[model samples]
Target: MSDAAGDRDTDRGRDRGRGGSAPFAPHEWQIAWRYMRARRREGGISVIVWYALVGIALAVGTLIVVMAVMVGFRAEFTDRILGAEGHARIYPIPVVQDDGRRVSAIDDYDALAERIAAVPGVIRAAPMIEAQVLVSRGSANSGAVVRGMRISDLQDLPYVAHPELSEGSLEDLTHGIALGEGVARELGAYVGDMITMILPGGQATPFGMAPKIKTFELVYVFRVGRADVDRSRVYMTFEAAQDYFNKGDTADQVEALMAHPDLLGSRANPTEADAALIRAAGHNRVLWTWKDANGAFLSALDVERAVMFMILSLVVVIAALNIISGLVMLVKNKGRDIGILRTMGLTQGAVMRIFFLCGAGIGTLGTAIGVGLGILFVIYIDPIFDVVNFLAGGGIWNPEIRMLTEFPAELRWQDVAASAGLALALSYGITLFPARRAARLDPVEALRYE
Candidate 1:
């Protein structure tokens, strides 16, 4: 080769390090991979790197599992809330009485509800009368919320109307009352049993006030699958409620069901755009979506999810830190070898890359293993939860308190990706300092005593 060409080649080699091969070239990878395998003298550092891999794997797996559970919570709660409360509620603007009492009497709500139901994405809009009362049958009693709707409108409510979601018959719901499964269980009432409803603060008498009392036959029972709700909801006919509550011919509010309940919100929700359409359909009085009531709970879950992730990521960070200790040891042990390579015209870049690759190898393997384990955990969450409950001798979860009968998990790809990416990034990022140190080691100093 010509002297000028040789000089150019040498300059390029010096700039890149070692053979000055292409960025992450085959030889560089080969050398890096080989260095990852430890010799007997380097056994201590090899063990540390192994620990790092395990640590990263465990951390990532935990992150995925925790996030999945949080997602599951949001999902389960959302499902139950929508089924029980519907998507949106339309209330008449309350008028303040002379005594400063707020009274809601939605006049002519039937036609208005039909108009709202005709809006895009709306499934059902039923005019309803809702109030709190005490229910009793025989010797048992419980507090309940009475929701009064027409038999036709009851058919429009998803959980209440569905044959699978409810038990007994809706044939006589117009004349009798339908109690929740839990309420029936508590009262030991049967489908044909008579149940008495007591409304407090009723009828101005010689004393303060007297309670209004009424009785109706139990026609059916509904199991909404949510403990708190199933135990408290009681359904009666709209006409019966009007007479019982003495509300004349007016209703309280209109509960509107959407085809996609979970999507009704601001924040890029698909149903957000249809909010205007529903309002423009006919009426736009006191309207509130499902999110308004439950938003605080969901927000708390999100904050918890994020906090848990940040806390769990420390495990991966600590694991990556282990790489630094191991690499530092390796650098100390490989001082003589580094000197020899440097004297032989090995470039600093190659030396740095070699060590960087070592850390990357561990991070990649660990992240993959963690991701796999997390997915498996989420898939078999129910069985695992049962086992855990058994180990704890049962009663680890209360349906009435937690509002769910079973433990839930939902694996999301974004969660997995975020976990893996974080682990790898920490692994790779932590590698740089040590790798640079190894590359910058002066040949003369490295070999001075050797």
Candidate 2:
């Protein structure tokens, strides 16, 4: 009769494990759910459980939002940099004399540019001269980089050609120059005004050397959303630059655009496009991709991203530790129940699984809420910023400094998945110790007090 009674109890437990009208199911899940839900008399969830849920949700959501913004900023910055400069530039290796004098002109540059243009993946290659010169309008003087390129080639460049000039036209460029918007503003000059350019090289006279000075009409003004470029760069015709710099047929460098701009290299690794350009330019000449030129700045951005992620992850860790504490307290509170279940033939592994389910449920639910909220935030970030600015009664964003007038966010699925996975892993891991302790409880001792 005792054997029959034991068999009947075992069948009932198995039925409960199969999720047949059980409050939490499979048996372990049912028990976990019961612990989480408040009894009618209790009327509400435990404060600690609520804290764990809210904390995990907030941590995950914050991480997602911040990472999305960082990714967006990096993308925008990279695009602007690549747009201002081409994928790669092939320049002549400077010939240094034993006396330490450097010759900075590329020999047979026209022919070399032609060769580079013929290389696969190279869309357009043009000879250019870049020199540092002093620019003056009235009495105001600012140091600037003057880039001289063929008008036709300049027009072919999307970044240079597409800007809506606030002042004049490129068609009037003949012997005139185009100033960046910031430069125009600083010098208080406008289109049709004359600006003086002072080159370093000068003619040798009896009165020592006189700096070469020339004046050109400002034909155009452009803004590319980059402060450094807008404030410090001016463009002129290649012929005009050659005449002013006293270079006959040589160029300072060869700038090339690639068919696929995304394949451009980063600080850590060289891309196939860079390799092809190098091979085409030959070993004697120096090749610099946009990545090589901007590596330091890009590296700083990457480091900032990594550090931010690590710092934010601490929030998740703290929340997971809370899960451990909550589960440990739960094990103590349910000691009598665990003992009764063990006496009724439930396995130790089953007891462990019950607590695991509880913690995992909280993590999964919180992650879902966080991910949903994060994506919603990113989608509406611009409108939210607008509302904030309206309430603030002024523009909080400075385009000159921020390079963007609105908040940028890009929601990457991989980032979301990784964040969720991390939270879930921590939640599961922290439950193990408490769950094991509960499973190993002595049934007689636990029920004796009860």
* Predicted structure with the largest lDDT when compared to the true one: 1
Evaluate all candidate structures by whole-model CA lDDT and list the values in order.
0.82, 0.81
Cα lDDT tens digits, model 2, 1-450, are 685465456656765775544433366777788888856543333666777888899889988999999988888777777777677888777889899979889868888889899988888999999999999998999899999998888887665777634578887888699998888999999999999999865555688877899999999898776777888989999988888887777899999988787687854587777677778888678777877877787778789988898898899989877777777778888899998997876766677788888778887887788888888888899888799888999668776787653466888999888788888888888878888888777778899978
Residue range with the least summed lDDT across 10 consecutive positions in model 2: 18-27
Residue lDDT tens for model 1, 363-433: 88989999999999999989998999999999989888887777878899999999999998898999999
Which pairs of residues have clashing backbones in candidate 2? Answer: 24-30, 25-30
TM-score winner among the candidates?
1
Q: Candidate 1: worst 10 consecutive residues by lDDT?
A: 266-275
Tell me the lDDT of model 2 at 324: 76
lDDT of 1 at 30: 85
| lDDT at residue 99 of model 2 (Cα atoms) | 92
Deviation from native of the Cα of residue 23 in model 1, angstroms: 2.7
